[model samples]
Target: MTEFQTIHPLGDVPPQSVESGDTSGITLNVRHEISMVQIFARNGREMELAKKLNIEGVPGRASETRSFTAFPLAPGQWMLVSKNAPGSGFGTGIAKKLKGIGYVSEQSDSRVCIRVSGSQARELLARGCRLDLHQSVASKGFCAQTPMAQVGVLLHQVNDGPTYDLYVYSGFARSFWEWLAHTAGQFGYSRGGRGH
Candidate 1:
């Protein structure tokens, strides 16, 4: 028998801090203990799927809770996220729950979640994101699929602090991080812990 160990997407990168002076305006964290699943409702079954999940019908919004968060990716697609211990099979559980109403694809290993937050968070993202992030247009519960630094990402605004969770493909995590670190330098940033 062979044994293997799970490695975090950004485990090899050292923690970083770029300060403009005595103050740091942004914080970056790699969320490693989360499980993500992409869900696509069967044609004409969007309402049934939402009802099964006990969430409002799929709209261009995000639904969050202490245990999980579901956000729309398109008209009939959504990404479900939840904190899970290693090997918890969170995606499998969701697949079972959704059963025939939706298709659930595990994205836990395919995507990386980077939490960007602080007073300057929105400012930093505006450098590369084209979305109009004005508070009135992109407050909490807002989510969209967009490109940042040429990398396709699912961006979710989680709070009024203007914090955002950028879910990028794991293969591009390092490149995205480098871009983020460089862009955030002017604002001064401190690296945070890997998980909750």
Candidate 2:
């Protein structure tokens, strides 16, 4: 591997050349592999770690995109997530600074998170979602636990760019893609509509 290997080859995650799809031209695409890392710490430790890391927000989050929705899930319980997968030392950086004890896990396989946002964001969701995502309830940083087309799902309502994030098990991407494709057709009937 060079300094950086252009992946998109054969793997559980994504390889190198994932393409932009266009059942209707909205162009659905994603990284071959979803990168995940989990931080396991006791209750009080999260707050302390957040303070030390200046926990203003989750890292690698991209909500703003002219007109879109990008919300975060409260950085929830695991403490935090970085743009890049951080290992033991990354956790230790905070652990040492904050004087706390905890464990860091690189969880690239356990869960698969897909970012979904675009002109026809809502339309694609209508394909297989049961949740009512109106303006008031589906605001930025807000999330809902629901299933898509029978699969368990965690939907994060974002503001600006990424309208939503679909969290599902690694085993269900193909079916989910099929579901999205069906609904996305209606969404792309007129082209990506500018809304979240």
- Kindly give the stretch of ten consecutive residues in candidate 1 with the minimal lDDT sum: 13-22
TM-score per model over all chains: 0.87, 0.58
Tens-digit lDDT track of model 1 for 121-183: 899999999999999888988888889999998999989887899999999998998899788
Q: How far out, in Å, is residue 121 in model 1?
A: 0.4
lDDT: which candidate is best? 1
Residue 50's C-alpha lDDT in candidate 2?
A: 44
Query: lDDT of all the models against the reference?
Result: 0.81, 0.51
Q: Quickly count the clashes in candidate 1.
A: 0
Candidate 2 lDDT for residue 83: 46
Which regions of candidate 2 fall more than 4 Å away from where they truly are? 1-27, 32-34, 56-76, 79-81, 85-99, 189-196
Encode model 2's per-residue lDDT on 3-88: one tens digit a residue. 96543221332321212433333445443433454454456565554444444335333233222222233453342333444233
C-alpha lDDT (0 to 100) for residue 178 of candidate 2: 57
Scored by Cα lDDT, where does model 2 land?
Answer: 0.51
